[model samples]
Target: MNQPKKMALIAANLAFFIIVGFFVYQRFGIYLNNPWTRDGQVRAQVIQVTPRVSGTVIEIAVVDNQHVKAGDLLFTIDASTYEVSVQQAIANLERERVSSKGAKIEYERLKDIAAKDAGAVSDKDMIRREVNYQQSLSRITVAEQNLIAAKLQLEYTHVYASVDGYVSNINFQIGSQAIANQPILALVDEHSFWVFGYFQESQLNKIGMGNAAVVTLMGYPDTPIEGRVESMGWGIAPADGTVGYNLLPSIKPVFQWIRLAQRMPVRIELEAIPDNINLRFGMSASVLILSEEDSP
Candidate 1:
């Protein structure tokens, strides 16, 4: 063929391939930008067991990594002190009741004597009886409050689990002193688990709230957990420190550095989380967000 004819044939083939490529891209081409897989830590609900009242530990029931149900026995403080307080409260309450009853009887006697026109119980005596009755009523109220407080202290002696979860690392032992606000141990909820994925800021446009993503874990990589975007966090890292809280880079490049993308953690709630496997906190996971668009 002539030189011009061969050149024309080659050009024609290139044009045809370009057209086909464009058509294919329109149908299935997706633009993905700045692909990275940072390590993801598994998050779980942690229960911090703390003492409500100051006491001496008498019974340490559960051990480290022990599973417990709601209202299960966790420990017991010495109830001897609380039991003595309860007895005192009960005695005071009984005394108040008897005094109140006696006041009522005295008031009734005064009423009868005054009605019979006897000076043995004068008007002053009736007035005194009325005052005593009111005083006795107030005493009874105070005794009732004391009784309630004593009963509450007794209940605090027996510690029970507030949540159903697997236990870990019991800090207290029998004969040890435990005070209020002390963290006895921590329990990670095996039933509740989710993943938090940090995606680049560039991917934000394509990924909307409710987009489906496939989650694979280092623990169970074969089992892909399907999840959807539950909600986008409002507090994104600031851009330029003016739009939000953006961290200023510590080191600046002298070679006219290009702008780098920032990553935001997107909380993903699994569409269905099965209770088959224990998903503890700080486990590694990888998620690939299924997107129709390549680069946002």
Candidate 2:
């Protein structure tokens, strides 16, 4: 309405526009200088918890999603059978030891007689006694090995956590039959957390090993995680010519005029995480890899 007020209003509008323009320019520059992708996921080492010895699960020391430390007991299989096996092995070993001692004594006695009087003990008899002693010694070794194996199997019945991690996907319960070498649950290694960013081929040139990276998880947008580029995938499975029905090559139809750039996984190793933040497997993330010159 007034001249002075009009000038003040115009000045205020110009200042606001300039500030907005500067902010936009700065963000655009950051994007142009860095490679970013929304196709990112949180990853970690998932260890399959498998039992070396099969038996009924008599006790479960941990529940699903429980945090565990290395050497912590996970579950207990019915160790009664293994205990019996160990006892049997010990008895067999004792028997072998006794037989070996007797054989050795017999062989030594024959050897002493033969040395004193060659005609009293035949050469064939001495040879037979020596062979029997040697065979008995061999049997003792075999029994020792069997005992060791039995003890190992018995130890295996008490499953322990192999690493510091979180137990996951525990589908079995007490009294559940566990088969040898079959995974009963999964353990997500807490210290092995990393990010896998699927970046377009065109952006590969901007990414390099040890490059600084920023990851914004979908679940925790306010807290950004710092990381570095560890490695890049060398290849991806081709979707074009895979074996399909009728034993023929199945080729995907693509537009002749448009070609989609293939995405390759770039692994990012996360830095020290904040105590407040929790990293989980398969969480969606947004990744930004900074240029070498811009990295701190």
lDDT for model 2 comes to 0.95
Give lDDT per model, in order.
0.77, 0.95
RMSD of each: 8.0, 2.6
Best by TM-score, which number? 2
Each candidate's TM vs. the true structure? 0.74, 0.92
lDDT tens digits, residue span 105-223, model 2: 99999988988988999889989999999999999999999999999999999999999999999999999999999999999999999999999999999899999999999999999
Model 1 misses residue 210 by how many Å? 2.8
Root-mean-square deviation of candidate 1: 8.0
* Candidate 1 segments exceeding 4 Å error: 1-39, 118-128, 236-260, 274-276, 291-296
Question: Model 2 shows how many backbone clashes?
Answer: 0
